[model samples]
Every structure is written in C-alpha cells, then in structure tokens.
Target: MSTAIVALCFSGPTLADDVSPELVAFARTQAAHIAARTDVIEHIIAQNTNHAHLTLEEISRLDVHWRQQYGSQDSPLIHRLMNTPLSDALRSLQLRSSELITEIIIMDNRGLNVAQSSVTSDYWQGDEAKWQQTFLLGPGAEHVGELGRDESTGSIQIQVSRTVTDHNGHPIGAVTVGVAPLQF
Candidate 1:
C-alpha cells in the first residue's frame, strides 16, 4: 500500500494531463509568428475570403473530397499542389524550423486544409478538438492537443493549434503546428 502510494506520487502528471508551460509558451509565440508572416497571412485570407459563404458541413465535405482524391498516388490535384512553388515554400519553412516543427497544417475557417507541410491522416479538421477549440474561440485561442510519437519522424510531438486571424482581427481559420517535445 505504501509502495503503491509512493509510485503514484512519483509518477506525477502525464503529458495528457498537462503540457509543460514552456512548450505552451513556445507554441503561442511560434503561432503568433506564423500568423504575422505576410505570405502565410495573405494565403489564409485569400482562402477564407473565397470560401466565406461555405457552411461548416459544406467545408467538411470538401475536406472529404480532397482527402479521397489525394489518397491515390497518381492524383492529379495532389501532384499539382505538391509540386508547385507554394509547396516548396512550405517545405522550406518546415526545414528552417529544424526538428522543432515536425508538421504543419493550415486550415480554412471551415476546417478544410489550405496547405500542409506533409499529408495528414485526414483533410477535414472540423471534427478534431484542436481545430474546434481554436476556431470556435477565435483569435488568441490556443489548444494543446495529445502527445504522441510520430512513426515516420520518430519524434515525440504535441499538436498545438491557434486561430489564424485576418488584418481586422477576425479569425479566418486555424493552423496546427506539431512541436517535438525533445527539441523544445
């Protein structure tokens, strides 16, 4: 009984129970920086503005369509999007971040993927807690998602999401950046 109590006390909090304050701060600061980038801001604004009238359901369905099409290796849309200069720019940014950033996913207001550094498990983020919390709460909102190991990168990462607001401070979408805990 005493040993059990001691073990429990020593175990402390799990990553799921709480994210370190330093990592949270790093995420917030990085998210703000990403939001302030001129090109990134412009891209988000343009995507959101173009699809401003889309309802939540419509946006989710669009995500499904994109995901289904991209699943095929010979997908024309994926090839075109992934081979463009824009993709090169995104990949460059990810490389510049070193190992700290494992992945980057930018979503439109409807939670549809606008751009991604790598392919994600899904396209629609509306159903995900990270997207829901940040998007619904608008700008200044942040969500620290689950901690897990990336099989491909073999890095322990936590998904951090923040609202992507426009010039007028209106949230146009959200961006989730994966931070490797060991690097940070």
Candidate 2:
C-alpha cells in the first residue's frame, strides 16, 4: 500500500494503538470462519452469469459513496457495520464452518464490488495490493489485512478476500469479507 492511499483509506475517529486482549481473541476467532467461505462467495459470483464484472474505476466510485454515507457517521454503529443482507443468504449455503463473520462482498473481474456485507464506504477497490497479486496467488486465495478502526464501535478488524471463477475456466471476479475480533 502506498503512503498516499493508506492516508486516504482511513477516516472518522481514530482508534488507540493499544489493542486489547479481547480484540486479539476476536480476530483469531474470525480467521477460520472467514477462510472457509471465500470459495462459497466465488460460487455466488459464478452463478450471477448475467452480471457484468465491474472495472476498478466503478468499484472506486462505489467506495466513495460508502465512505460518504457510512464512514462519515459516528452513531448507530451497528447500522454502519452490518452485512446481514449478505450474510443471511450466505448462511443458507451450509458453510463448512462458522467462525467469525464480519463482512462479505462480491467483486467484478475489473475489481468493483458487486454486492457485499459490512460495506460502509468504498475505496480504491480493496487497495492496490489486491489488484496486483490476485491472479498470481490463485483463485479463492485469501489476504489478511487490517481494515482500520470502525468509528462507531472503537474496534479493530482484519479482512480477507478470495478470487472467484466461472465454469468457463475464466476468472470472473472475487468475494472479499472481514471479521472483527469478537472482543470488540
């Protein structure tokens, strides 16, 4: 991540550097649950055959909206953080494991978010890091990242993203999700 983007990626009230023990445990709890579902998210993207994959620019625009609406707020925290719409449907998929679920979303081949969980504000299409290595790392590959502090909850979170593919053996897009340590 460049210093410029990292600067832009963060917003709202800042969090303290001192991470609590509870938060550490929460992040750990979220890891496996998030890990198990990337492949499932990919399946969903694949099924949406009619959906056109978004370009990186489109995703960036959505991120801008997300930031303007949700990221700018500091109250009614849950509203800013919930991905229930996405997660509820995901639950029906009979996931291999239920660990820590924070957020989830589908991205087009061009790296725009199609639909997702816990999306407050969109920014730079999951950062430049994702765009660079997604192909080299393989489909459904996951990346662990610190998603900055949620102004409402004062909690820290780690996010993961997995690539998605269609039946034609083509890379269609990806599913990116996050899990905040329950300790928050």
Indicate which candidate wins on lDDT: 1
Q: What is candidate 2's lDDT per residue for 1-184, written digit by digit as tens? A: 2453344335432232333444445433443344345554454465345335655565566566656666445433324324344544544432322544545555555555444444435533546444335523565555545556644334445555555555554556655545444423
Each candidate's lDDT (Cα)?
Answer: 0.71, 0.47
TM-score of each: 0.77, 0.49
lDDT of 1 by residue, 33-141 (tens): 7766677777777777887898877776666766777557766545654665545676777788867788777777877767777766566788888789998999888
Model 2 poorest ten-residue lDDT run: 12-21
Best by TM-score: 1
The TM-score obtained by model 2 is 0.49
